[model samples]
Target: MKIYETAGFPNPARIRMALAEKNASDAVTFVPVDVMAGEHRSEAFRAKNPDATVPYLELADGTCIAQCTAITEYIDGSFDGPSLTGRSPFARAHISMMNLRAENGLLNAVADYFHHATPGLGPDLETDQCAEWGEKRKAVATKTMSYLDGVLAESPYVAGDAFSVADITVFAGLAFADFAKVDIAEELTHLHAWRARVAERPSVAN
Candidate 1:
């Protein structure tokens, strides 16, 4: 298998962390994509992934899987490690729900704010942008942070006691928020504490 990604990018960082958690970093080849140079918009790269997103997984037989969540699902399943996606039926659903919340409410929201409201990736990539919508999504990101803080206040992890992809998603979302200059209120202590603990995990710290 192969993964085409841009190094150090937020979404790609999620996949890298998953691979580390699975202890399967060597299981596939890492192909770097020059996203800043608009290589993802090129015909060659677009043929492999129509969405032209980074951190996509390519199977040996030539199947391409886009989206960080789906790629992380494949990694959690294929590798022998503590499950990141849940082992039980109910757990799976719960984790999935939480992951979606993190993705849409936090990660994608911050992304929209960065790409639209700010001078994200310069004029070349950000051809069309809506400042109003981006500002709205920024609000959504901040709200999601508070929601996650409340969730952490109750459960040990995002979904439950077990560490799962939902945790990973929220972690990445917070990272993106920091990069986008979004403020995480100090009152969200639970969220802050959880982030500190997660940062120490081998998948992230090492």
Candidate 2:
């Protein structure tokens, strides 16, 4: 399998982390796509993903998979080593629910702020309203993060005591927010500690 990746993008990082967690990193080839150069907008890439997004996966038979969540789940399902999803049925449901919450509450909000408020992808951002929207988004994201931090304080991971896909999904979005200069409150100490633990993984370094 071939994975089209970008160094600074959040979605690709999620898949990469999943690969590492499942011990499936060696089975795939990495292809870097330059987002700054607008390579993803090219005809060749659009053919692979009509959405024109990065973090594309090409199966060995030449089928393409887009979207980070789908790709991560596929990888986890295909591999046998340490499941990124929880071991039990209840754990799986919890992780899945938490993952969706993180995506909707944090990741998507950050994307809206980044694309519409900031000068994203080399395009000039809009007016003060955009910035206001961004502020709102940031607030929503931080509040959700604070709640997750409280949960993390009680449990070792976001979904439960086990490290699962919920942690990786949330981490990818949070790390991207850090790159974009979004600040988290100092009071969320549990989240800060959890971030450090996730960073210590080998996949995050790459």
Residues 131-193, model 2: lDDT tens digits:
778778877787888888989899988888778888897897787688767777788999989
Instruction: Tell me how many clashing residue pairs each candidate has.
Output: 0, 0
Please identify model 2 stretches exceeding 4 Å from their true place.
124-129
Q: What is the lDDT of residue 205 in candidate 2?
A: 67
Q: After best superposition, candidate 1 residue 178: deviation in angstroms?
A: 0.8
The models' CA-based lDDT, in order, is 0.94, 0.82
Worst 10 residues of 2 by lDDT: 120-129
TM-scores of the candidates are: 0.98, 0.89
lDDT of 1 by residue, 138-192 (tens): 9999999999999999999999999999999899999999989999999999999
